[model samples]
Target chain A: MTGYLNIILRLTIWFLLTADLSWANIVIGVGVTILLPRGVTNVGLLKDWLRTLGEVAVAIPQAYKEAFEIMLYPHREETVVLERVKPRRTPSLIFLDIFLITFTPKTIVQRYHSRGWYEVHYIQRRETP
Target chain B: MINILSYTCIILGLVFWYWGTWPLLGRRSVLYKLHGLSVADTLGSMAIVVGLLLRIPHEWPLLVLALISLSIWNTVLGYVLAYCVTDDGTHDVGQEVGHGG
Candidate 1:
């Protein structure tokens, strides 16, 4: 009885969170079928369900943390700009570059010139851990 | 004349988007993406601005002000993020000085 109730509750929460019924329904349907109503008590499914909740809510904290970090960081008053990087031959990589640059706090994208290079200005270099 | 300019600007903006998303952006290229965004975010926005301006050229002041506000916002956002990296250094100073074994 408890296992049945868990599935129903999980289904409800999942539905509530995802407004896209068709897609969500399909996924939940397949997932439940694979796991089965009997295996509903399995810790894996329960763990995943809990994690999904966190992912939804954790975005708020993540944003706050990023913002806080940004504020507390010491940025030089001077602007360090990178000149346009002309990628020879293969030029279909601008979006990746833009997202990567914007995603990194240390780097700032200044401008992309007609010459096919993006100008980057950074106060400090950051290392990936 | 105004319509032509609007279409032209929009097309140019789309071109920027295409370039930014395609050639300018890709994996293994952080600088490219940053540069692409600068173009994609600006020129793509310019497309909308031109369209609006063409529709109501008299409202150019509003567009100008909007541009200014957006520029300020972007600048602040960039600076704020940079500040985060800088603050990390301050935290590390004590650790390095206290225990350098």
Candidate 2:
């Protein structure tokens, strides 16, 4: 729809603050998105999208809490990343780590249950010895 | 040249995050699922990093610090996300490449 086109155009302008082929590519991307809108665009992409939107509307508080935990203490976590590394239970800790990492800016949950050792990649080496 | 690339990346990333992903997941998607980051995550955040790298003044330590944290998290989140998307006993029911809705 025309509404989508207008939004893309504005984004193009934002990118154009610096002049280069990068900007040109960005503009082209915007134009393409406008011309070929898909997925849950236009509030009518699918029934699933609507259901998802409603669910997300309800999940804000939990998400916010998780974000808070990750941000407040980003230093190396005290908990063992893998059970083999330290003999603690994992389900709860791994779940908490995942939620926390997702919201916080510096950390992320990389992989779980790989070759019998839980693994993750950190953006920084704070936790690594 | 850097400025241009950075700005272009920022715009592209923002579009996918705000317009592209927002409609499907709404605000919840922003929460960072950590399972499968989606192409949007890396593309959008890298755009941000490139854009910020171009404009930031050396005196603005606070801004740089914040942006640094953001970029790191984006990468971590995306790597986790990709794992989750392709992990065992699960399947992407909707919105993957080369598939119909």
Candidate 3:
């Protein structure tokens, strides 16, 4: 019940976003949503994903603000440092981390280092673990 | 009023588009160049689509698809490009990354 509701809600949002209320597109979206793999029926994962997305949304303005600051202070010099980070996660999670980090302009994955460590280049290296 | 907001979004999106491209001219490494290009392109393009969405609310379906595709496609392409450019082989991959590079 919840899963179907989730599907309907998501498809509705998709419809609104697309602004294409055509019956064919709606049907296709519904079919695709229905055919998606149902590995884990945990609602908590959806919540977590939404929360993370919100955090990312908040980070964008901050990124733009930093970009503006960089433009204003050309001599400030952003230090691009390389760091080895071994994320204690599964392969899928590690891929997600890489995707997220690379998607953001502040940090990017250069390559995989030795012993499961990812060598990442960051504009400003944060000190928090 | 809505038109004003839409224009603002479009102009801001253009600024981001230009800003992203500006770094490409710098004598930076390939990673840095790809970073600027992909990030700016994704955000700027999405912003433009959103602005268009506001301007023409009836065309939301296609615009929304564009926005969704922008996020997924841009991220995946960036990962693929980075992976291809990274020439250090971990195990035995038959010289994949190096060959791609």
Cα-based lDDT for every prediction: 0.46, 0.43, 0.61
lDDT, residue B87, candidate 3: 68
Q: What is the C-alpha RMSD of each candidate to the true structure, in Å?
A: 17.6, 16.7, 7.5
Leading candidate by DockQ: 3
What tens-digit string does per-residue lDDT give for candidate 3 at A32-100?
A: 778776544433345544545565577656656655554454421223334444434434345555666
Instruction: For model 3, name the residue pairs that clash.
Output: A18-B60, A18-B61, A19-B60, A19-B61, A20-B61
For the predicted complex of model 1, DockQ is 0.03
> What DockQ does each candidate score versus the true complex, computed on alpha carbons?
0.03, 0.07, 0.25
Candidate 2 per-residue lDDT, tens place, B10-59, comes to 78667645532443453323223332243245434545655776776542
**TM-score for each predicted model, relative to the true structure:** 0.35, 0.29, 0.65
User: For candidate 3, what is the DockQ-based docking class?
Assistant: acceptable
Candidate 1 chain A: minimum summed lDDT over ten consecutive residues — where? A87-96
Docking class of 2: incorrect
lDDT of 1 by residue, A17-104 (tens): 4534697686976487446546433232444444444543553335334333433553323243434553431222343344344433
Measured by TM-score, how close is model 1 to the native structure? 0.35
Tens-digit lDDT track for model 1 on B24-80?
Answer: 434523432443454455435555666777878766655755554443354445434
Please report how far candidate 2 places residue A111 from its true position, in Å.
5.8
The DockQ ranking, best first, is 3, 2, 1
**Native A-B contact fraction in model 3:** 0.30
Q: Evaluate residue A55 in candidate 2 and report its C-alpha lDDT on the 0 to 100 scale.
A: 49
